[model samples]
Target: MTASPADAEAPLSAHHRKKQPEQVRRALLDCAAQIAAEQGASAITIQAVADRAGVTKGGLLHHFDSKQALLAAVFADLLEQMDREIDRTMAIDPVSRGRFTRAYVRACFSDRLLGERSLWGALSVAIVSEPALRSLWSGWLDSRMAQHAETDGDPRLVAVRLAADGIWLADMMEKAGGLKRYPQDFERVLLAMAEG
Candidate 1:
């Protein structure tokens, strides 16, 4: 027999239910990240994230107590992804000196991490404006630097990293203003600098 409309609308069995707490939380974070990447940080409202994730506002709140809290969590998640990317890139480098610096430069230029329309582009402003977010980023940087001090502590390597930061800032500005200021081979130059 065919199922009735009411029966069809009934909730699935426990085994079939996929919206576990952790899954729901991940969905909420993914939705929030998409909104930020597409429309900038100002567009990430609780209601918008809830709608995008197919959850109620209350459900979103149950995962994140406030909008600021949600933003911080999103920022932290991005940092974690970046850390993993850096490690993955570092592993392939046979050079001992400046390996971490080279990996960092590569990660910054990676399309997956900081591409033209990446979440980092959207959240850059928030990182500067929000002290808490800035602190989180600073802490992450500090820890990474400490961990890689032996390999990446040379002044020349530090200069390479600083140059990479400048390139990143320029790229962000180019995205924001539609201006092509940096040359195409900037990454190559930075990588070469990291080598020496």
Candidate 2:
């Protein structure tokens, strides 16, 4: 039997069919991030993200139960992917100094997952709004703080951590005019701090 034109036009990939769920999940998260980047997190409604992703609200719900869930997935995916990329970059340490810490600092500013960082401020606000998430995030932070204090002999470890976060947050909050501009030597400053 000969195939019709419509049949010929059908998608040609079994692999793509198998990956549909992952693709849909990624699309929804990307759509939410784009919305946050464009109009802030308050603009990130389920309907809006569903429409942007070219999926029905029901379709979106199949993957994310609520707006918070979607936002959480987006934020978590961003961090996870950033960690992977930073780890890869850190593996090629030419300077051979504070390899892991420098990679983390680099990841904070040079996140390549999302183009604009407006989503970061949105996610930060979201993380604080949810108590469970807030606890998880703070506990993770506390552990990192402890590690920093133990590794570095500096008595001002708290100040160092806050300053590093301030530098990164300044860049991330650019859309909100939180910081007019990161100083020209911002990365250098962070790198120097990473070394200390």
Candidate 3:
């Protein structure tokens, strides 16, 4: 049989069949979190993540050039998860001006997230401590507050949202070995405020 130009491209297609870059990046991020969860944030080194993901250090580096980048990816993953959770909750009642704050508060109280803040809190504290990611982290915080500025522009509306954030932060800190957690009724009161 005669070989054609398509045959020449077969080798290139075979190379493309390998795992895409995103998959590798996600693997590294997952491994990093697993490491942090099991061994604490200080254990989330590039080699540890690369080993956990079963990828070469170079391959891991290809997706995340340094440990700080990998840590930033973990933080980004948390932000993305929170965003998705908020949107999912917002779908329940989207019309009200308070929907944004309500959804945000409800999302923070998700069964998966409620009272399991140790791992997340520790990782977040470490992520913020990284000099390379501080600006990006701060920007995320800024945008999070500003996101509802149009519908939630009123001081009262903003206060409810900020209060929700404060409540969640305090709850997480309490879980991180601080004082006792806020009263269980706090969520109920916050929901009322959000709806008011």
Task: Pull out the clashing pairs in model 1.
Answer: none
Please rank every candidate by lDDT, starting with the best.
1, 3, 2
RMSD of each: 3.7, 4.7, 5.1
- Residue 134's C-alpha lDDT in candidate 2? 69
In candidate 3, stretches whose alpha carbon ends up further than 4 angstroms from where it belongs are 1-19, 111-119, 144-147, 176-179
- Candidate number of the best lDDT: 1
Model 2 CA lDDT for position 132? 53
Instruction: Tell me each candidate's TM-score.
Output: 0.87, 0.71, 0.76
Q: What TM-score number comes out for model 2?
A: 0.71
2 or 3, greater by TM-score:
3
lDDT of 3 at 162: 77
Kindly state the number of residue pairs that clash in model 2: 0
lDDT of 2 by residue, 18-108 (tens): 5488889989999998888777777899999999998889989999998878877777776667558766976786755455566666666
Q: Which lDDT tens digits does candidate 1 get at residues 1-196?
A: 9999999999997458775899889999999999998889999999999999998899899999999999999999999999899888888889989999988888777763345468888888888889989999999999999999998999999998898788777767667332245554777898998886
Which lDDT tens digits does candidate 3 get at residues 1-196?
8889888766654245666788888888888877776677788888888889988898898888888888888878877887888877778785768777777667655532434424565575575578756776678767866877776667886777677667656755566332255555666787888777
RMSD of 2: 4.7
